[model samples]
Target: MNKSVALTGNEAVATAMKQIEPDVVAAYPITPQTDIVQYFSTFVADGQVKTEFVTVESEHSAMSATIGASAAGARAMTATSSQGLALMWEVVYIASSFRLPIVMPVVNRALSGPINIHCDHSDSMGARDSGWIQLYSEDAQEAYDNVIQAIRIAEHPDVLLPVMVMQDGFVISHAMQNLEILDDESVKKFVGTYKPDHHLLDVKHPMTVGSLFLPNFYFEAKKQEAEALERAKKVIQEVAKEYAAISGRQYGFFETYRLEDAEVAVIALNSTAGTVRGLVDEYRAKGLRVGALKPRVFRPLPHEELVVALQHLKAIAVMDRAESFSTHGGPLFNDLRSVLYESKERPVVTNYIYGLGGRDLTLDELRRVFDETLEAARAGYYRNRVTHLGVRE
Candidate 1:
C-alpha cells in the first residue's frame, strides 16, 4: 500500500530524488531551492542513499559538475531558482543540445532588478526556447510526482533531453504538506538501474560525449532533436499511464477544470493554476461558465492537447507572470496565439499579464479578468496590453 506523510514541497522533491536513486547529486544551495538540496544532503549523511553528493561553489559549477557526471554514464540531478538559473544559462543550452538527460528542479521566482525573492515565472520563461522539456507542477504532490516522470521522459533513448520541473517559489517549495512518499524498493524498480547505452567511460569501443559539428551536420542533428522530442510525447504519456496504474495517481498533458461546455476559460501555470482552480469552483457554483486550463508539459508545449482543449471555448484568457518585453504578450500567450493561428477555426484568445514582481493576486482580480475576457469575446478583439494585477502607482 502507498504511504502518506507530511512534507514540505522542497522536502518532497528531495524525497522523490532519493526514490529515483540517482548516481550523482550535484547542487549548490540557492534560496527557496536550498531546502531541497539540504534534504538530499542529509539523506546522504544518514546513508539512506548511496550516491556521490557534489557540493559546488556556484550554480554554474553545479551544472558543470552534473554534465560531467552525466557524461560518465551516471544519472545526475540538480536544483536552482531565479538568478541561479540565469547564471547557468550558457551550459543549460549545452546540457540540452548534448542530450544529457539531466533532471533539474527550478523553484520559480521573479528575476532581479530591484531585488525581489518571491514567486514568479520570469526565470523559466527566459529559457522557454532553450530546447529543454519544461513541466510545471500545481502542488507539492505533482512536483514530487513529475520529477520522477521527468527522469523517465528525459532518459528515454528516443527522447534524450533535459527536463525542468518548475514549482512556484514560496507557494510550493517553502510550503508544508502531507506527501505520500513512495517506497525506495518500488522506486528502484520503477526508475531501474543506471544503464546508459552511450557513455564516455564505456570501453567496449571508443566513444565521444560531445563533439563540435560544422553547420552542415549541426542542422540535421538539431532537426533530429525535434524528432526526439516528438517521440517523448509517447514516452511521457505511456509512463504516466503506467505510473497511474501502479500508484492510483493520474496525470495528463494539460488539466481541464469544467471546460467541457464552458464559454470562457482562463489559462495559467504552476501554483497560480491551483488558485485559478479554486476560482473556477467558486464561479461554477454561481452558474458562470468559466473554466481553467493548467498546462503540465511546457517544453513540448502540448500544442495538440491545447488545440483540442480550445475547441469548445469561445474565448480564453491566458494569465502570465512573466512578460515578453514589448510584445504586448507573455511567453505562454505568444506561443498559444501561434498555435491557434495555425488552426483553421480558433477561439478568440486574450492575454493577461498578472502577478508581476510577485504581486499577490486575490479572488477579486481573477473574477474581473474572467468577466472581462467573456465581455471582450462578445465585443470582438480585446486589448492586447498587459493587465497588471494588484498594481499600485
Candidate 2:
C-alpha cells in the first residue's frame, strides 16, 4: 500500500530511512542536510525504528563511525552537505577503498571561500573521484526512491562500494512536493538484509580491514576498487528493476525527455532537470526538436547509455550548477564531452555553467540556452563552446 503525502526532500529521505531501518546511522548536522538528521533522530527518540543513532562531533568523525559500523557487518548510513562533506574527505576515500557500502545523502552545496551556504554541485562533484556511486534526484520522489535503492546497490556483493544519493540543497532539499510513500513492509522486503561476506564481528573467521598498503599493493587495491565501481553499473540496473517492480516507478542511468527525434538537447542534473523538462515541453509543443537529458547515476559515467541517448542530436548543451574552475567547462559537461569523443555519430556539445552559490537560473536564461543550442545545431559551430549562464557579464 502506497500513500501520497507532501514532503520536503530532507523529510522524504528521513521517512525512507525510517522504513528501511538500517542497523546504524552516524551523522553530523550541516546546513540544508541538518533537517534530515534532525527528523531521523526524532524517530530514534520515539522508538519508531530500531536504528541506533549516533550523533558525532564532526563530519569526519561521523563518516569514520559509519565506516566502523559497516565494517562490523552493520548497515550504516549518514547525511551531510557542503563543508561537512569536505571535512569527511579523507574517510570518503577510505570508505570506498575499503568497500564499506556506506550510504550517504549529500544535500549539494557550494564549497566555502566566500562562506556562502547554498545549493551547488561543488561538494559532491569534488568527491567524484572518491569512488562512491553518485545518484542525483530531480524531486522529492526520486530522492526518496534513490536512497532506498542505494542501500541495495551499495550492499550488492559484486559491488561493495559506498553510494552518494544527492539532492540540490534548498532547491529540492527544502522545497515541498507530493510523492508516493511505499508501505514499510514492501520497502523492507525490497531492500532485504545487509549480509556482508566478511565482517569484523564474524568470530568464526577473524579478518582484517583498513590495513596499510604500500606501493607494491596500493596500485592493485585501486584497480580492484575501479573494477567494483564498473560492476556496480549492472547492479544499479538490477536493483532499479526490482525496485520498479514493487514501487511501479521506473528509473534509468539517465532520463531522455523528447530526445528520440530531437536535433538540439540539454543535459542537466537534480531539480534543474525539472525546469529543463518544462522548457523542453514548450519547445516540443512549438514544433522545435529540442530535448533534455537528466543523469541519475553520474559516477561510472554510464558512457554507453549516454552515447545511445545522445548520438542522434546535432547539438548538446550540458548545464553544471557547480564550476569546475577548469576555465573549460563544468564536471558534467566535461564528462559528456569525453564520453562522446569516440562516438562515430557525435553531437557538437557545449557547456553551460549556471546557478553557482544559489544564484537564480531563471526560465528566460534557460530559454536562451536552448535557443543558442538550436542556432548552433543549424550553423554546425558554437559561438562559444563554454558559457556562464545566469551570471553577470
Clashes by residue pair, model 1: 6-178, 7-177
List model 1 lDDT by residue over 153-258, tens digit each. 8988888899999999988888888877678777677777767788888888678767888986999888877887888888889989977876788899988888
**Model 1: lowest-lDDT 10 consecutive positions:** 380-389
Each candidate structure's TM-score, on Cα atoms with residue i matched to residue i, is: 0.97, 0.99
Best by TM-score: 2
In the range 1-393, model 2's lDDT, one tens digit per residue, is 999999999999999999999999999999989999999999999999999999899999999999999999999999999999999999999999999999999999999979888998999999999999999999999999999999999999999999999999999899999999999999999889888999999999998898999998999999999999899999999999999998899999998888998999999999999999999999989999999999999997899988888988899999999888889999999999999987887789999999999998999999999999999999988998999988786
In terms of lDDT, model 2 sits at 0.94
Minimum summed lDDT over a 10-residue window in model 2 is located at: 338-347
Candidate 2 stretches greater than 4 Å from native: none
> What is the overall TM-score of model 1 with all chains considered together?
0.97
| Clash count, candidate 1 | 2
